[model samples]
Target: MTTDTTALRLYFPISARASATRFWHRLSAPALAHHLINAARRSGIQQAVLHPIQSGYLKGEKLTHHHPEVTSMRHPQCVELIDSESALRKFLHDHAAELHKVRAVLLKCEIPLIPNRQAG
Candidate 1:
């Protein structure tokens, strides 16, 4: 059965550091993707995708560096998840702690998805 309007798209703003960036040992992009994938499996949501944003800037304070040639590439990474409204809500509620661990932006949009027609 096709997903209904209850279907929602959730966007999460992540980083090169991923979810565990705030912790002592930061997570690499692949590590973070694995973490999220596992979490989704545990949460019973099948469809998810991790996206890497290229050539984007952040909206926070400037950084201070000790060395002259150590400029940081701090572009934010991202992931977008699609699921039923209820499932999305439940996932958010269940993973509140994870949210706190990472700097993220969670957005819900109600855009209807029209699948492309197959070539006959």
Candidate 2:
């Protein structure tokens, strides 16, 4: 039996904005999720939580992990780095504007079979 316990959805735009004035049309939630699931399956993760990314900051979750949601888009410059630590630093240098969306949703894992823990 495959032991599938952890259920955390990971979502984010593929081409995260590198600047306030740049938005890539290649970014799509469905496409990104499809690729992610395929990669996970290939790596032997039998099951995984899936949801659309809502919002986030430099490191990971926004506002001390207790704010309102989890995950976020890659800041423009960070997107440029792809997998470099330097890219992350760029995000830290510019996180204010990218993290100011009011209509962002708290991404639900696989349609929410279980209710999420309420923020305290």
Candidate 3:
């Protein structure tokens, strides 16, 4: 079966150094990813996943990759949140102040629904 759902993908830098304008104003605050995850949990999202990209570039920026020798470099990160359309929309609306500074994409998609069967 196919179930309709909404997917919200947020792309940002892994390091706060690269996110000064987006989320690094406060020194005591948690990383943007963690903060967003907590917000999603509180918003009752069905699922949230954080993906660390090995090599990629954000809009109008140079390509970057994770280096074993250099840990200070900023790497790309993508946070995916899947849930009902209304729920996801509400989450975005509630966090618009913070979200407006980041690159966010929302899409309508279908997820497969599997039946849970117990062996007799």
Candidate 4:
């Protein structure tokens, strides 16, 4: 069976930090990614994945890669989520505040489902 699906990809800096509120409360890169993943799970998203890139750069930034000599630097990270179009739309709307801080792309596509056969 083929069904409609939407792929949501969120891109951000791996070492970037975000403020949670007006106060000093902040979230590290890992923490922010985890928070978003948890939110996706709670929102009934079918799948959510976090990918750490070894070398890459975002818009208006210089490319960076992992080096043994360097101890700290910013790298690109991506969070991918797949689900129904409506479900993803709702998720984006619900998490607009947090999502606005990152770059996001939504792609519409169809997913084919294959059934399993039992051995006799």
Candidate 5:
């Protein structure tokens, strides 16, 4: 049987898919990401990763210049965090007021983590 446990995933945009400034509460996307990251860490999330996006577009938004062939429009980034429920709850509590300024998604889902194997 696959042992599935509850884990929380948080996703937020870090940069715009363009050279122009995209604002999140008067801060640039990357700046906003930095602000959010600091908040997340201070709220007790142990680990998170910021990944630069290559070729993806958000729905209902204007088509971003996110084509794989385009190199100039490649600053957009996303940060992902996977952690336990208690820690996630604490983060939500801490950032409750600031949460509305950005497009942050928190998902409660199940994932099958690969078991680590060691060779002697």
Candidate 6:
């Protein structure tokens, strides 16, 4: 049988220390997941997986079902940070090098396939 490979937009929510460099860094896992879910909705990909890198964990959720409001990426390492566009820009400016590391890790994530319905 031919398998269909769906396009997925994978996002990793890192600790504040890690995301400090990306202008768009402080966005929460749930918030970012919502953005990606909207992208999936536009792209017509019904299913995808999310990995919370800060905690080194994986969670399966229906993209279409996640809340659409944006929020902060609150982990022990990232609390007390403002989640604004301007704030993110300032954070990126102050921590460009460290943000690159976050990007590198995010780039390496692999989306595993969902098992067959019978097995699942």
Q: Please give me the total number of clashing residue pairs in predicted model 1.
A: 0
Q: Which is the better candidate, 3 or 4, if ranked by TM-score?
A: 3
Which prediction has more favorable lDDT, 1 or 4?
A: 4
Judged by lDDT against the true structure, how good is candidate 4? Answer: 0.78
| Candidate 5 displacement at residue 96 in angstroms | 2.2
Ranking by lDDT: 4, 3, 5, 1, 6, 2
- Taking all chains together, the TM-score of candidate 3 against the true structure is 0.76
Note the Cα lDDT for every prediction shown: 0.53, 0.35, 0.78, 0.78, 0.53, 0.35
Score residue 76 of candidate 4 by CA lDDT: 74
Best by the TM-score measure: 3
lDDT of 5 at 99: 53
Instruction: For each candidate, give its TM-score against the true structure.
Output: 0.53, 0.26, 0.76, 0.75, 0.54, 0.28
Residue-wise C-alpha lDDT for candidate 3, range 1-120, written one tens digit per residue: 566688999887776322234454555556788888878998889999998677897787688877867743457778899998788888888887777657889898865667757698
Candidate 5 collision pairs: none
Q: Give the winner by TM-score: 2 or 6.
A: 6
Candidate 5 per-residue C-alpha lDDT over 1-120 given as tens digits, one digit per residue, 9 for 90 to 100: 243233443333434322224456345334545665676777667677676665554443444444566543323456665567667777767766655534556666555577667797
Total backbone clashes of model 5? 0
Cand. 6 Cα-lDDT:
0.35
What would the C-alpha RMSD of candidate 2 be, to one decimal place? 14.9
- The segments of candidate 4 whose C-alpha lies over 4 angstroms from its true place after superposition are 18-30, 67-73, 111-120
Model 5, CA-based lDDT: 0.53
Pairs clashing within candidate 2: 17-76, 18-76
